[model samples]
Target: MPTVRIPGPPGLPLIGSMVDLARQPLQAMLAAQRDYGDVVRFAFGPPGLRGEIYAVFSPEGAHQVLAGQAANFRKESTLYEEVRSTVGNGLLTAQDADYQRQRRLIQPLFTRRRVDGYAGAVAVEAAALVERWSAVPGGVVEAVAEMSRFALRTVSRILFGADVEAAVDVVRGAFPVLGEYLLARSFSPLHAPRSWPTPANRRALAAQRELYRVCDGIIARRRAAGPGKAEGAGDLLGLLADARTEDGERLDATELRDQVLIFLLAGHETTATSLTFALHLLGRHPEVQRRARAEVGEVLGGRAPGVADVEQLSYLTMVLKESMRLYPAAGIFGRRAVEACEIGGHEIPAGADVMVSPWVTHRHPGHWPEPERFDPERFTPEREAARHRYAWYPFGGGPRACIGQYFSMLESVLALAALLQAFEFEAVDREVPIGQGLTLQAEGPVRVRLTPRSL
Candidate 1:
């Protein structure tokens, strides 16, 4: 069989796609997909190195790399590598045997039934957040920062099973620095290596140290509680602390730290970003917000929302789904081919890095009509059923898909619904610049005018 030459722009020698990717990766990838078809070859670094990358735009190719033939690829991308510096072989960065073992041990912690039990606690926090916002004299809220705090609190409580209010504060301060550091490494060709003593590196290192200390404290306190006390407590930390793999091996201290890092950082970060975007979208679209509020009113009848109300808030679910589709919290997914593979009839060489962007694919014209428009109805049951499984994956696809996806979704919907029911939000700006850090976030604080609804 002839090796198919993947189509893409012929850039200047030495540095190929690096400049364009650094400037605006989402736009660059979108254009590559548009001009070069489903499979576009990108030369990011030296011609002979593994830095030469390929972008997969079509659903068929995404499925091949992410799901159907996932084993042929590994989480060896630059993104995961940068993430590993902080997480250190946690589920997100682990591969093969280590990943399988960790996932098996941690899976029960996030089971549907187990996660449902958290809904009440999450709802309580959501209501408390609304109360806090209402107490604001001016009723103007910084949506991203507010959501970050709320998400941090919720995730900290759920994961730690103890009041780590002080620890949450540490995480809040450190997360943005870490996010900016990771994003810079992912984009800039001139980015300093972790070994360098750059100012950003210093900040990232200090932030990481603080986060590691926080994780260690959580683990030590839980361990001090002992098996009986830990097992009796039903939080994620407890479950993980007490968990043993099929072979009866438990995660060691370092492994515990890594898992906490994943849950604390990635877990809270993505949900916070998604909630911010959801609120921004709702604020921009009034009819959608009104309809959503109506659903909440009809369902809750002026009472605080509960776990059982999740099913009843179908329209709010659609709104959240549409928001993710429009501006996915994690915009791009990357994988490295462990073995040569064929995708979209193009031969992908072994060791090549491959990428799929939710920001691009979700807006593909063939998959979404008026792709730029915000239409919650597009997520109606029928339409979703008809679409490709990989077409709208905000949580990603295949075995390596986000384990906390359900938890994040339930948390986001509850928070969004509760807030919308209590207050009407209006965006201060016609356009908000998006910042692509560890996750997608509004570049600056999302300021919104909040008007408390009459119960």
Candidate 2:
């Protein structure tokens, strides 16, 4: 057996590497990679602690851990346990046979044919958003919030038949509470036991219940009304509500609830973040913005975008790809060793945590030239063809890849094309710092001035 080599900062007595990462996650990880080469390992938790864990980060190492010997690694128990407590055994948090079953059952809904059905709704909602924004005075609009609203509306229409304008407040009111609890739990050891009586956790759980209530009501009403009754009833909720497993078993109430919750959360928020970052990048690079606007103009000629129009908007797709490469919505994905394994010739013992950060890999010096420059052309078909398949995985890869990637890409292209056709945007302030959290969101509101495009 080849001897395993672990790279990264030397560990301190009793504390492992937690302090360095907590102080500055991005910089710390970058520095570790610089010092330790592509494959690096670091420990966390108190030194000599019974439950201390180690993690590895390398493009090749990550590939090996996630795809090469995947069975040896599993979704980190921390995330599984946390999500189970909040959302139950849905696809996002479930593992093994249950996850496999749910994935098999739900995969049909995200097929090209099914997701293409949503393009009209996406374009319609985006056009409405652009029309509403036309009235705002020339100054930086909060792109993050605006995109979130856009994505929420898109997801609601497709998932629950709700308009963005109508469902915005309900979803907005609910998500922050849920996000706060999830974020707090991610870093704090006291999280699990504090779900009771504490206001934050209580509010989060309440929000979860309320979300379920709304989805349940929508599902029941759709069922009661029968097929073809509701205007947009064929959305994800309806599909899942009526879908059957391979064995012909239908999703029970709890299973339906979990899938709905996952779609509601995952479908909108991450895409919104991606859109926000894309807009931010576009605003910063006016030339790229002009080219994108020109492409939209030439393609649709002022017509509202539809599913067919999406295929012609290749520049818009490149813009989104480049933006995600710079600021991936989900910055990092994590797993844990379920058994002792060798990755990059290094031993990863059972119970150790592993993280593959797109935030780092997407910007790896070895893979991308002039990594920080805002250049959309890098994603041109010719350019994209030159990169390794695993080199630019914004939505992840392998069996566990995000099932809604095509849906999101289509949604983003239509939304951007619609907005660009209707309005010309410029940054109010170009120096906003980005914060990496559950998603890559602006550290503060991204304000952009919008001027109506000459029709």
Candidate 3:
């Protein structure tokens, strides 16, 4: 194989491309791919703190790193370590045997059959949102905040069940704190250790403790209520608490807490982002919004949507897919190379930081013709089948793909369809800037003007 230095943009002495990256990570990554090829090398920081991220922006490269040569990469990035600090050994941050065992036990709980039971719960929340929006002083709402509320409420209800009302406020307040802390800690090349009493660390500690207390209290209540009390209930926590392996093993208390934290945070946050941007995009394109609404109207015919209806909301599903293609929640993720590997004919040194960006790859002109347009028809069956799978992986791809993929889809489709059926939206901000947190966040306001649908 020929050895060639990966081409990338150069920068000032100590910090290579850090300014541009910090300012606009998605745009920087895309520009890099446009200027260089699919594989690009970027170095930042200084000396001992220096970081070299090998950005893989092609479908083949993403496949190699995330699937084909998965064994050669480890989730030892700073980001995972930061998440582990709060989440313990949950599947999201666990490795090796622990991950395999967790996946085995938890996989059953997230299967289509099991998560389908969540549709009713999602519909309830969607209806609640519709009610809330109906009462707004004016027919306008901040799409980002409103979507976040809907998502957090839905996840809380599914996780906490009868006790949901109690947990919602606590979770909504505390998660943003923890998310901010996690983002800052993961990216900070130099900061006081978490154990130190810095204000940020102190605030993070308080938020972490508060969240754990809420989850712990709920778990205790469920345990005290016993099996008979929750027998017919299919809440996420109850399902996880009751999940038993073929050998009759179950997640212990600590493991239960870890998994619940992952679900509550990742679950709500990601779906909120998907819903927010889908709404934003739909509002931006009146024709697309009209078409999606027509599909929802035809499918539900004014009835509330449920799990059974999710699959039939085809055009709306495409709208969500295209939204995620443009604004994936987990826009960028990292893995550390454990063994030397070659991806896309470029040699990746062992211990190198490898970043795979769905935000960049999904916009590849090779896969998406007018990559920047809000085009939902791109997700039609024929077009989707013709494209490379990894090229549009909003939920990721491979063994480590998001376990909540279907659930997110179900929730997003149901909420979106319900909202679209109830109201027509016009974008107040045609272009919303994004800021990276634990999940992608829309910077500033994502405002949408709403008019109740005459139907």
The alpha-carbon lDDT assigned to residue 362 of candidate 3 equals 89
lDDT (tens digit, per residue) of candidate 3 on 133-190:
9889878899888988899989888887887887788888888898778766665566
Q: Model 2 compared with the native: what TM-score?
A: 0.92
- Inter-residue clash pairs, candidate 3: none
Model 1, span 205-315: residue lDDT tens: 999999888888778877898874853357777788889977899998899989888888878888888888888888999999999999999999988888889999999
TM-scores for the candidates: 0.95, 0.92, 0.96
Which window of 10 residues has the lowest lDDT sum in candidate 1? 43-52
lDDT score for residue 381 of model 2? 87
lDDT of 2 by residue, 61-91 (tens): 6677667777777876565566677766787
lDDT of 1: 0.84
Each model's C-alpha lDDT?
A: 0.84, 0.75, 0.86
In terms of lDDT, the poorest run of 10 residues in model 2 is 47-56
Whose TM-score is greatest here? Answer: 3
> Which ranges in model 2 have alpha carbons more than 4 Å from their true place?
1-5, 10-24, 47-55, 162-167, 190-195, 224-232
**TM-score of candidate 1 against the unseen true structure:** 0.95
As for TM-score, the candidate ahead, 1 or 2, is 1
With a 3 Å backbone cut-off (N, CA, C), the pairs that clash in candidate 1 are none
- Pitting candidate 1 against candidate 3, the one with the higher TM-score is 3
User: What is the clash count for each candidate, in the order shown?
Assistant: 0, 6, 0
